[model samples]
Target: MESLHRDDEKRTLRRFLRRQRQALSEHEQRLAAQRLCHQLKALPEIRRAKRISLYLPVNGEIDPTPLIEWLRKRRVEVYLPVLRPFSANVLWFVAYQRDTPMVRNRFNIWEPDMRFSAQRQNRLPAWALDTLIVPLVGYDANANRMGMGGGFYDRSLAFMHRPGPSPNLIGVAHACQQVASLPVEPWDVPLTAVVSDQGYVRRTR
Candidate 1:
């Protein structure tokens, strides 16, 4: 079937792009992170944001932590995505501070400890963020995104499908991850833009 073939193509593309980023040297990773921050800070969405959500980097995902200090200095509230307990591949945005307790989730990715995230005061819904620095396995010039195939973000931001306020979702990845084109799925959430160490691609469609 056509659907089966698209799924296979997506899997192949994901594997290839993942390897491309993971193959970067430590030096290259650091440089890319720095450049990524520079591009982010210059964006008006980032500068004017009072509350934002970002994820910790893993598997060579472009690092957005460097912007934390700058955001903090301006009294901006920074949040990190915590895998929601007992939820179906969904995320909860939890406050990330110098003292926020951290623990590895089932995926071996670090997130705010449940003890801290349990308190409603320490977290916010995805829709409440001013902007979100999202991670992706791949993207295209049109700003279409290919995530880890988990559909976590797509499900979380499904509220956007309706007419109402929604956070600005900004996908970030290594420049090498860009492909000529990508198959957009019905469940896929459109991003405001995709930024990389090299530059950025904003969605016009």
Candidate 2:
């Protein structure tokens, strides 16, 4: 079927790009992360944001911790995505602070501990944030993103499809992850902009 073919194509591209980024040496990865932090911090949207959500890098994903720290110093509230309990393909953004306890989620990624009842008080809805820095396996100049195929972000950000205000969705990735184009799906949420080690790619469309 046509659907099956598109799925296969996406799988192939994801495998290739994941391998490409993972192949980078430690030094290369570190340098790329530093440059990415520099570029991201310079973005006017980022500097103006009072609240933001950022992810901890894993599996060769560009590190955003440096930027997170910078934001914290500026008194900007930083949040991390927590897998919503009992919710299918959805996430809750929980405030991340120095004292916030962390636990590894099902994917083995560290996230703010949601088990503590107090943590719930700090949680914010996805659309409530001013900006969200998302990790991507691959992206294109058009601001289309290729995620890890979990659909978590797509589902949580589905509100963007409706109307009204939406947080600025920014995709972060290594320069090597840039593809000529991506086969975008109807369910996939497009990004407002993408920041890579090379520079920022603002979506004209």
Off by over 4 Å in 1: 117-119
Q: Global lDDT of each model?
A: 0.92, 0.92
Model 1 vs. true fold: TM: 0.97
| lDDT tens readout by residue for model 1, 82-103 | 8888889998898888988889
Our model 2 lands, by Cα RMSD against the true structure, at 0.8
Note the residue pairs that clash in candidate 1.
none
